[model samples]
Target: MADHAEHTEQDKREKLKELVKDARIGMLTTMTTDGKHVSRPMALQDVEFDGDLWFFTYADSDLVAQIRANPQVNVSFSDAKQHAWTSVSGSAVQTDDRAKAEELWNPLLKAWFPDGLETPNLTLVKVHADSAEYWESAHSSKVVTLLGYAKAAVTGKTPDAGENETVRL
Candidate 1:
């Protein structure tokens, strides 16, 4: 039973990585002090998912302040063409590790930080994922989906929703 649980965990992690591999952006949702949910599109950094995700932001950004007050956050990814979507729940922390910042830094970030890593207020946000839920449709092709909908409409039956699972990280 223990072995099976471990295998399941590994399988979930692999599936998550595969789902987000090609996604370039994710909606990062955070809670504000007034108890309002704010979501913004964040560029997904180019890194392997290993129970943690990283992003570069400004120290003075609202996102950083919000995380400082409330660490809980959700990052969501979707791929319309592939009919895949995932929502990752985690806690975020601000880090000042220069080495890590350098490692994850890329040329594209220069637009936001003109001075590169040396840019003032530059900071890293690390999200340690606790769990995630993903939905993947079996009929990924457009034609198949249309056909499924058509069949469902004609038969007055619910359309096949495909697979959905929640995994603990």
Candidate 2:
């Protein structure tokens, strides 16, 4: 296993990217006006992370209003097959950056925005992630991990599940 101290900023960013690359969907949590937290699934826009996450939404969405009220948010991704999970904390803002929209655009998004890029109220939420924490199991296979767990159970010792680290951007 690799030591946490050995990972540089670039290494951490790469690791985080690797963990969440396959997780196209993530839950975005935002604070409401009443101080309550609301979470909804958002498609992770296909773009180089670079310490930021992007999502497509409507300009009039409650999410946009909430983000305007409080920029602090959290986005979480999980991949059961890999036994990996990641949570990113950041500040978000709504924008209509056409260039960025074009960069991250995919045809599948047409299902949401019926008129494609011309869809009225179409907007993007850019999340400037401050940090991310992730957990990943050492063994990717369920059978292998179960066996390891069984071995630990029989031996009454802790199982070496995996590595977990928090990376600051």
Candidate 3:
């Protein structure tokens, strides 16, 4: 039983990485000076999850100011097709690290920054993730998940819907 539990925990950790591996966009929520929370869709740079999340944005963007005022932020990703979702809570800081920016740069970003790496006001925002929570269906297939719901409906018992785990960095 102990071995099983250990494997389960390891699997959960790997699941978090798998879910975010293909997730290119995440909703970044920041607190404004007026104590209001605002969210914007931001493209995530580097699919690797190593306790930090990186994003590129204009230095003049309101989010940069919001992060300066309040570093606490939330970044969330969802994939409806796979019924997986993740929420990451962290503190963010904006920096003008040109070398880091060049390393994470992608040609697709040219759509936003016409001048590419030389774009003026371009900066990097790094979020030091404190914790992350993710949920995903436990069943191997949607058909199996649906059957679980149907069984619960007939038996009047709760369905084995999925697994949810929280990881602390």
Candidate 4:
């Protein structure tokens, strides 16, 4: 029983990483000082090399204030089809890391932060994903998925969700 749980956790972590890698945008949920939960779309940075997600914001923004008041946050990443999604729950930190913020800044982001390029208020919102989970709907959701068959043929592991697993970090 313990072994099975361990394998499930391991698979979840791996899947979570993969989902995060594939999805570029996510809805970040943060609790405000007033105790209201606010959610907004954010870009997923450091995806290719790490699990830590980075987002750029104003140093004195409302979101920054909310996050500072409550560091616990939930970040959700979903693919175009929304069939695959990952939710990362962890603590968030607001820092005046201009270089890192610039590294992630682009022209598109200027629509919100007009001074993103030059404003000293530009800051980095880093989420240290402590635990995450990936939920993937079966491709066809009819008989069985083609990916399942492919996995069995290649690795000899069962391709069914009955054989599905999750992993923890």
Over 143-165, each residue of candidate 4 has an lDDT whose tens digit, in order, gives 35666678788999866543233
Return the candidate ranking by lDDT, descending: 2, 1, 3, 4
Give Cα-based local distance difference scores for all models. 0.85, 0.91, 0.85, 0.73
Displacement of residue 30 (Cα, Å) in model 2 is 0.6
TM-score of each predicted structure versus truth: 0.89, 0.91, 0.86, 0.72
Using TM-score as the measure, which candidate wins? 2
Q: Indicate the TM-score of model 1.
A: 0.89
In lDDT terms, which candidate is top? 2
Count of clashing residue pairs in every prediction: 0, 0, 0, 10
Cα error of candidate 2 at position 115, Å: 0.7
TM-score of 3: 0.86
Model 3: residue 113 alpha-carbon error in angstroms: 1.1
Worst 10 residues of 3 by lDDT: 1-10
lDDT of 3 at 62: 99
- lDDT pick, better of 2 and 3: 2
CA displacement after TM-score superposition, residue 99 of candidate 2 (Å): 1.4
- Write model 3 residue lDDT over 1-169, tens digit each, in one string: 0223454645666677778765668999999899999999999996555668899999999999999999999999987777788998999999998889989999999999999989999999999888888877777687888899999999999997676778776
